[model samples]
Target: VERMESISRVNSSDHVAACQRSNVIISLIDEKLKYRDSRAKDFSAKCQGLKFLPFVTKPAGFSLNWKGNYFKMATMFSAAELYTVEHQDVVCLLKPILNENSPSFKGCGSISLAVKDFLGLIRKPTINLVLNQLKEVANYCEDITLYQENITNACYKFLLEAMTQNEANKVMITAELKDCSFILVENTYVDAAKVAFHLNFEAAPYIYPLPNKYKNNFRELFESVGVKRTFAVEDFAKVLESIRQDSESKQLTENNFQLCRRIISEGIWG
Candidate 1:
């Protein structure tokens, strides 16, 4: 009996030691899982883009910069998305960035269209302000029903009819546009697609380093819009040079030069 008791005690000691090691391993695994979860959350937040803040009244100061192109591009994209949500007229606001001599060109002295769209003129609500106004619209137009009723313009009659479809359709659309109540406010002075285009173009140099799937999706956004899938600026001088060198060009008269120039310009710019 004495020998049996001693052996039992030894066995119990070994079992306790094994349990202690198991506990330690379990704690390490738990910590690793928690760290992985935290990292995932941080990456997700970064990818979701910037959240704009609402302003009660126009502030006395505003500024935006090109630091951290990823987040900056996301924030600008959010602003542009908000602008589109409001269904504002985009035609009058868009000016060709290549046309530097035009009076309406807003690039200051730089040729970068991204700079012009984001910086904008002092008088206009720039991209930063557009982001702020997105929040303002969210704050004021919380109730989609009431917001829809307030649409009084004759031109927006079709839009209103679309908004008031069957209950299920209305619910779906309201769910989509609920965050874009600012679309008709006439606040943005730049085209949303152009803003998206130039910003994406500027960020192109950095995009190759990203994962293949992410890079593909980032590029696909522009294609989903009517814009083509290229960020390259065609050289008009090169086109002219090619035309001059063409054998068929020798018979062309100078009177047709203006017409040819207009057609070539349309082919390139349009």
Candidate 2:
């Protein structure tokens, strides 16, 4: 019985030591798994082109500093995904950025269109105030991680519509008097593809040509609207260019341009 008891004690000590060894192995495995996951996440983020704060990045093709080409020619794009919970927040976050030169934003078409729609709804100081407030909110959203979970396409569309409709009061067109001058400056000779993109026309999937029939009418339309016919004191081009320098002149030109765009978009002029 004494011998049996001694042997049992030795066996129990072996079992305890074996258990300690097993625990050490398990701990090593867990640590290795954690390290692997962290590496994978970093790799995924890099592959997705996730930047620090601003997600916008132009293509590598535009690296060459050529003077003649436009800055947005290479297409600086943003690929921000919005979540349902975060969609409204994201729209709210981006409103100020969207509002600034919105009609000219070649990056995000939806945001630009939404801003245009919002301005159509909300007019003057009130819209201007909200836009100003949006500027404050736009300063945030840096904490948002690129690969957010639970994001759906529907949520994104919903956010855009809601934010757009939120400010639905239209602006007042107080004055519409005699004549406003505008310049159709075409310094850079770009093809139809580039023109379609700059104008934000339906050039996706395929760039359909502007039908030779409409091409002649296009020139006639502008001429009918009236370009300055040569002035003695200031050159015709310089007079139009001068209007662009003043804030009021700038606004008037924009208003006229918008009316022209509307006529074309609505097919009313055609």
Candidate 3:
């Protein structure tokens, strides 16, 4: 009977906690919806005349480049930093005691309870959930690219079949003269059209006649498949600006040297 009563009490407490968690999540969602609605007008204005792909979705996570390395939003915060009481000092203080028999400790609640609550908060569907959504969007982009490539190849094969045997013979005699001409014209038109349509498009002024050694060096430097072939001066400036901003935000400056010293000192003493 005692065991049954204990189990029942435990179940009831769990049900209450679940209800509380549900309420908190619902409240957060409500606030998010209200904020979203308030920004709807501004968002719509910014999206004017933009024909967004119907299948592509916005990534939920913010992108960050740290020390010349790109990292996902969730991974930016270190595990130790995430559990540190400095970030959620109040929550650490208010967390319910996990066991009455535990020894007292400085800084926050019992170490085990603090760790548990920290992990729980991290696991919750907060802003980090947006990162998962972004990964899905990236996958969708890859799928679309593959589909487009297949369509392009199919169209090329269909056009190849349209030529007669006599025309094919003529093309072979002139080293595929008709095929070469068609390809050249199509490429020129597409390149011109792309430049006209896209403001960011900038064609290379001249194809560099690189020596074999130089070509090999270039290939060795940039062997990644998906890396962009070229970058504009403006793009380089933007990257520099991003690095400056990130450094400034992190206070990695002479003025913050003392702060770092203090942190190091604390670690040593602890």
Q: What overall lDDT goes with each candidate model?
A: 0.29, 0.27, 0.27
For residues 38-95, write the lDDT of model 1, one tens digit per residue: 5533433332232221101111221111112223111112122232212332111221
Q: Summing lDDT over every window of 10 consecutive residues in candidate 2, give the lowest-scoring window.
A: 169-178
| Top TM-score prediction, candidate number | 1
Clashing pairs in 3: none
TM-score ranking of the models: 1, 2, 3
Prediction-by-prediction clash tally: 1, 5, 0
TM-score of each: 0.16, 0.15, 0.14
Q: Supply the global lDDT for candidate 1.
A: 0.29
Evaluated at residue 45, the lDDT of candidate 3 is: 28
Task: List model 2 lDDT by residue over 201-238, tens digit each.
Answer: 33211222233332443433222323222212233233
lDDT of 2 at 203: 23
Question: What is the full ranking by lDDT, best candidate first?
Answer: 1, 2, 3
Worst 10 residues of 3 by lDDT: 49-58
